[model samples]
Target: MNNLTTEPDMHTALWSLVRNNNKLFSQKRNLEKFRTLLNIISENGTIEDLINIMSIFLYGNNAQKELIENTCLPCLRKLPCEDLPKLDERLRSSISYAGWNINETTDWKQKPSLFELCILACHPNGYTRERAVTALANHYEPVALAIALIRCNDWVSPIRISARDTAVNIIARINTDELMKVWIVFDRVSHGQRHGDISLSKTLFPLLRERIPSNELHLQLESGNSRTRRYAAEVMWHTHQSLNYSDLQALCACSDPYVCFRTMRDILPRLDQRVRTKLLDLVKTKKWAPARLERLRLLMTDQPECMHDELLDALCDRSASVRNFARFHLKEHSDVDMELHYQRKLESPNISTRIAALAGLTEIGSPIVADHAKRWLKEENPRIVAAGLSALPAEVIDNCEDHILKKVTNHSLQISKAAYIALCNSPPLSAKITPYFQRDDLSERQSIYFANLLLLQSRWEAVAHAISFCRHNSKEVNKCGVFWLQRWVYGERKFWMTPSKSDLQDIHRELELSHSNMTEALMKEIRFLLDSYQ
Candidate 1:
């Protein structure tokens, strides 16, 4: 029979060699046989012959097997392509899919021979490059994903966005040690999301601890974004459980109110009376909401020696809520002497002292001060209301929108303008008052405030409308409109800026081609607005 079912000497010899001694590939004779199998694969022989030869070779020493599979098998499968774009789509698809299955198999160590073949097959085509990116992203190896993202960034926008999102996802999941690897990657790249970088760095803070570079965390705590400050405080708190006095001082002095409050609140019990008094002195001048600062006051009772002077002094603070927190903590922790001392500071003749006393009388601040603040919301005196504006809760200012709007009709222009400014601070105002631009009843100040908000949000339609009203006789209103328009064109301090000359020309050309009159009218408005500025 042609098949030679029982007497195929060549097949029997190769199989017997592999079976008797898996290390046979290291011998000169078996090495020649492996080379012959690779040659057959190169010449378009059956893949079955190549697979059999690979099995024999797989049992050899790791180094030699790697060499044959990496160097020889890849050479056998190399495709012929006249151009990258003309590469065979079928080959690319087959190779990419094969790589996925090979990578997932339990015998992955034996599959690099095949995986090398796949990588070589797809190296030429654009489709292969995109799929390679997907593979790199989904692969379990973090280092591999980082390399692929960096390599793919220049491909196209869709590819770039995919790579960036993948990089972010990979970075967020890696271990703290792996995070250091990613940080080096971060330092290597010229650009990445600033917020993302800060976040990743914050997460890796402990890995950086007490090393010379640990001071970098302190710097971030002092000056980075709010998220960075919050994370830095958390990391420092965990890393330095019994924080040194100097480190405590640094944390306590942080400009971010939350960070300062956390540092004082966590360490107050552990600190001596001297350190406690220092923390109390610092908390007295703070202007942030009281609930956060109240935790620091609670710690004062554990150090009774510090509360005597600290309690009396805090009872005289300008912020009534601060005084109330001090009193509550003292009453909860200290003896009667501390309470009477706070009461005496409350009764002092100084207006600030009287304000402080009133602060304690109502268990927070005198309800009367808040009532006065509410009344001053309607006051025509700018200076008096400005003080009240500092004390009023954001919610009260927000709920009193219509009342503040009526104050725009107040006799004094300065007071009217301040009232309008206050309205801009209200969260509900952006919703309630943006529609005022559509009405004819807009005042000069109201129109100006509306225009500023529109400019701030980059609302082009509103900017165009406000520019149309610059022709009104009121120079002040015209000036404000021109100011915001220029700001829109030039960009704000932390927002979008005006385009360059080339960009402006390109936009003007596009506008000219589509809507010539609209373009001309807009350009005319821009010119008039600019002249008004000068």
Candidate 2:
């Protein structure tokens, strides 16, 4: 065995053992041999040999196995651009087997192979450039940070956007005032353009405080795109020692719901009752988009009574997102006024308002509310009726079983599809609904949806059936089946035994002929895992 191990041909030695014995190399012993081979390669193996060995291990038995940290990773990191393409291919192959743990590779940031990623990003070929950008972002190498920053200004907008987002994330981790200034400048330039994102801008502001001059800052904040100006007001509300009369007037009168929400949240704690009352008035009258109003509602949760009048008013906001917040906050108290507000929406002229009202009623968890929904199911508009049924609780679910099953079997595809989703969600839906799988009336997308729902509940027998339904020739079904299967496989790997060789053979056979998007996705994952070992 020692003589065989010393042979120049690493693959030949491993193959001999695999072919000759049932268990000559268990995972533990195989791991040790892998480490030794890695060391030998790091010292003397050619790149061609390395790529070959790595590719073979990928998408095979070694996919789940861990790589031994030999000096090769650090050495490979220092390899030149000419050597990067080979290494990139090998890395993709070995992803399954490679330990992504950053600490393992010594001086990993200083590696030249990492720089090769930058070259790939700026590669002449468009597809190669896109792939390189993705590969670089995913690599998580700290040394690539500076290069990524430069690429943010890339001539191509798409590449620049990717690079900018990557740089923002990397900068976020540094958590220093200096980095914040850089982000603030970049954000200003990109504001109202394609790259402006509110969440990222708000985050950079607080960090910029001590680094940027206050006088210069206030001017920048008061101007710019609507989103930027709103965030600026939020910054002033947080950092201003004493709100100047002008600042107070602006903060009080700002029309953006986010600006108002942030002001209320930040200043309410520090202001006198007189000021808080003034701010509450601003919240009530300001026409806000639904999402921002939701934030204000959540903020009011600690003292709902203080702003009850305003929150109740928001329940009628034209935006469903805002109404969602209203229902959520209002339900926490469950007062008569809030329930009355919901009841009115149920009869409102707008279809979305009716949908929001049903969801709101469900959130309240009242039997009276559930009963109301059941009555609405008899209405002519099937869509509204379907939504009403969807909002019903489990106990209510049992009572409506007959009606729901009938709808599932309805000739109208929309009605059937909606019924299928609702029934699958309801606990009373077991075995009774299982027969629906055999119904040829069901669309492939509908079947795929059910398959995923079953997988989520860990109903393996049901999941197995669902997997078979993946035969629906739709790309959507194939994509969904493959995703759920991969998730199922990952979960099984954690708690279950390693898959048998026969199982791998079965998957490989299917891989060759299957047209499912999932098939390709699964193959990629399997290959990534196998490559990790290399």
lDDT for each of the candidates?
0.51, 0.54
TM-scores of all candidate predictions against the true structure: 0.37, 0.41
Cα misplacement distance, residue 2 of candidate 2 (Å): 62
Find the candidate with the highest lDDT and give its number.
2
Q: In model 1, what lDDT does residue 328 have?
A: 66
In model 1, what lDDT does residue 428 have? 40
Residue 137 displacement in candidate 2 (angstroms):
35
Question: What TM-score does prediction 1 earn?
Answer: 0.37
lDDT (tens digit, per residue) of candidate 2 on 1-534: 366554457656544443433254566876577566656655654666555444333322322122422333454444332354445545543543443222332233454244345434544444544555655655554334444554554556677656666655655464344343343334443342344333333453444454444554455455646655654674576566646545655665565556655665566656665555555555555556642463465447546566676567567665667766666666666554666778887788988677767776666555566777777778778777777667767777677777787676665666667766776765334355557545666666556555554444434443443355356566576567666667765865566434445544444554444435335666576555433423
User: For model 1, what is the C-alpha lDDT against the true structure?
Assistant: 0.51
Native RMSD of candidate 2 (Å): 19.2
